[model samples]
Target: MGNVIKMDVYRMLRSRSTYYILIGLSFFLVFLINNSHESLLDSQKGLPVPKAIVGIGFDGNLLSDQMSLLQFFKVFARSQSFILILAIFSVLFINHEEASGFTKNIAGQVQKRGWLLFSKFICQGLFIVLAFLVGLVTVLAAGEMSYDEIVLGNIGQLLKEVGLQFIFHLAFAGILLLIITLIRQAIVSLLVSVLLCFGAFAFLYHAIDRWIQQGLGIPDFTMNNYTITGIISQVSIDSAKGQLIRAVIVALIYGMLTVGLSVTIKNRRDL
Candidate 1:
């Protein structure tokens, strides 16, 4: 399993597409941060209303240094709804290998199919950590230059944020991996994963919000847990414990169900 994981990481780093996708995402995020900088700077010019980052509706207040980190995160979180960066990377990084027949050749040498897949996912974690940390540093350095003194979260909270987001990406990527592994094609898995990651989540966000306010008398979708990153960033520890539990249960069930289907299909497919 360790060797499999190492090999996947090496291959991932070597892939030109992987590097291209990472470069594109880095630029996309930097664009967002730059746009936010301009908007906020303009709004500070004798205006009362705060300029919103990607329009998450921040009232025009200069973020304290610590809260500036929060603002930076909020900007990224708003764009995350599209699953834009993640979808691109996971598709080309994971599914493209299978579609191009690299996975089958690698599988010939692996001891266990599931372990091999898990190793690939682990490689993804490494890939994302590098990308995310670079992005975070970019935002933090730029934000500090523009704003007042602000200490980002403690190391533990920072790691929690990264780890949780990483898990979310892994879970979503696992879906794409499983789909492509079973179907042996790239297009369908790519489309389905993106649509589910973005489109379905959009629909569910609305539906869940309406249901919660109407049924439970709680008007806070910000405090819900149907989405992993959202649940962590938006919800408080005391207010959303139930949603947290529900999120875990749902994530596990969906992950297991998809993985089971993939394994079943792989066993019967005679590939």
Candidate 2:
């Protein structure tokens, strides 16, 4: 497993796409910071600041003041752009081994082929952590340079949000990994992942919820409440403790189920 992980790390580092994605993220942060600064300036001048420019908080409130570093982090966390980028990256990275027939060689040597897939997941987690830290540092430096006052917010809350977001992202990545494992086609997996990130299947979930409410007469029941995408859409810094707990539980369940299914398929099927 250690050797497999090391090889994955080496491959990931050598890939030019990895650096390109991170560089793109840095540019995105710069754009957001510049827009935020402009919005603040316009507000000070008594000009009408666009609602879109003001942005919405996790609590659904319009941000009237200059955004703090923590607030910027929250914006990045909630943005579909980050998830979309990860989806594309996962498709490319996971498909590389299969496309090159590298997996066949490794699978024959390993007693437990499932560990090979698990090792890739470990590397996925590491990449996510690196991306999160890179985003944090970018926001911190850029926000400080752009704003007159940079509020750091509560340290505990920041850490909590980061941890929860990481789990949510990892679970989402697991779903993409499963899709890639099953389909083994990069283009199809990429399309499905993009749709998932954009909530393209939301109508299906909503229709099911409606049917359950009408047939079973369960008025308070909602499938979104238990879904990763739904939970992430609603999670905010001000979310109640109970809500956070539920989000964590849902993330864990989805992550474990997807990874387990992928490993089972890997072990039973010839790679």
Candidate 3:
């Protein structure tokens, strides 16, 4: 397993897309902060601020002028842009082996073929963490340079939020891995992942929730509450203990189930 992981890391380092994604994310963060700074200047000069800047908050409320480091982190973390970037990266990264005809050679050499899939999943998780840190540092540096008084509020709370976001994101990557493994097509996987990031299946989830509620004779049984995306949307820095616990549970369940199914398929099927 360790050897497999090392090889995966080597491939990741050799790939240009890996660095491209991270570089793009940093530029995106800089753009966001620049826009926010311009909006702040406009508001101070008694001019109208754009609706886009006004709606930057997670709750669709006006962004506070005194944006704390925590608030900036939350805004970036909650946005689908981060997940979308990681999804595309994972799809391309996982598909590269099959596309380059490297999978056949690697599968024959490994004692347990399933370890290859597992190693890829583990490496994806590591990349997700690295991306998270990159975004965090970008936001901190950009915020300091843009704003006059950005507070460093509660380091513990900030770390907790970062940890929760990482788990949720890793689980999301697992879902994409399962899709890419089953479909074996990068384009199709990318389309599905983009749709998921944009909440394109929201209606489907709502319909399922209604059906389950009617079947169980329950007034408020929502399937979304137990879904990974739903859990992510509901969680926040000020979320209650119960909500946080539910988020962790849902993330773990989805992550484990998807990885397990993908590994089983890989082991039982011809490579």
Candidate 4:
């Protein structure tokens, strides 16, 4: 398992796409920081009413507040949608290997299919950690440079928020990995995973949520369970503890189920 993980990490680091993504994210942070300031100050120079409306609508809290780490980390949460980076990396790491016949070659040598797949999961987790580190450093450095004095919020709460978001990414990657492994096709799997994560799931979840809300007069069910939008919202810090707990439980369940499915398919299928 260690050997498998090492090889995967080596390959991932060598891939041009990985560097491209990191470079792209760096530039994205620059853009986000440059334009993230509040327009309320600008309103003082012009029409206050219109600027206030614009400021309210602008989703640039990470740049505007500049103090809280949660706000800083919200850049990826805001811009990456629910699964953009995770989907791309999982597809490249898992589906691309299958498409190129690398997975089959490795599977022939590995004794346990589950262990092999779990190693891939570990590799995915490593990538997530690397991404989180990059985002954290970028935000903190940018905050220090942009704000006069960084006013941090609750440290414990910030850690919890970041940890939950990391878990969400891992869970989402597991789901994508299962789909790619089952389909065993690169382009098709990539498109399907992206659409499912980026839009399809959200759309279906929202429809169900709205129906439940209308019929049952429920206020918080959708916001608390498997709802990508709710999880990514900047205001999630203010959500009830129960809601966050439910979201984490749902995410873990989804991740475990998908991993089990992948192992089952690997064991039963001829691949």
Q: Whose lDDT is greatest here?
A: 3
Tens digits of per-residue lDDT for model 3 on 1-271?
Answer: 7999999988897889999998998888777776767766777788876644322323323246677767777767665657777888888899988899898988878888788989999878888887877877887777767777677788898888888888988898889889989999899989998878777788998888888788778878787678776666667758888878887888999899999999898888897
- RMSD score of candidate 4 (Å): 4.4
Model 3, which residues run further than 4 Å from truth?
A: 34-57, 144-146
What's the CA error at residue 119 for candidate 4, in Å?
Answer: 1.4
Show how many residue pairs clash in every candidate, following the order shown: 2, 0, 0, 0
Residue 252 error, candidate 4, Å:
1.0
What is the per-residue lDDT of model 1 for residues 163-251, given as tens digits with 9 covering 90 to 100? Answer: 55555555555566576676555677677666554444666677778888888888765333565445433432223567545655655
Residue 237 local lDDT, model 3:
54
Residue 67 shift from truth in candidate 3, angstroms: 2.2
Least accurate stretch of 10 residues (summed lDDT) in model 3?
Answer: 53-62
lDDT score for residue 79 of model 2:
57
lDDT of 4 at 166: 80
Model 1 CA deviation exceeding 4 Å by range: 38-67, 81-83, 144-153, 200-224, 227-239
Q: Is candidate 1 or candidate 2 better by lDDT?
A: 2
| Candidate 3 local distance difference test against the native | 0.79
Which parts of model 4 have CA positions greater than 4 angstroms off?
38-65, 78-82, 143-156, 210-220, 234-238
Query: Model 2: residues >4 Å from true position, as ranges?
Result: 33-64, 144-148
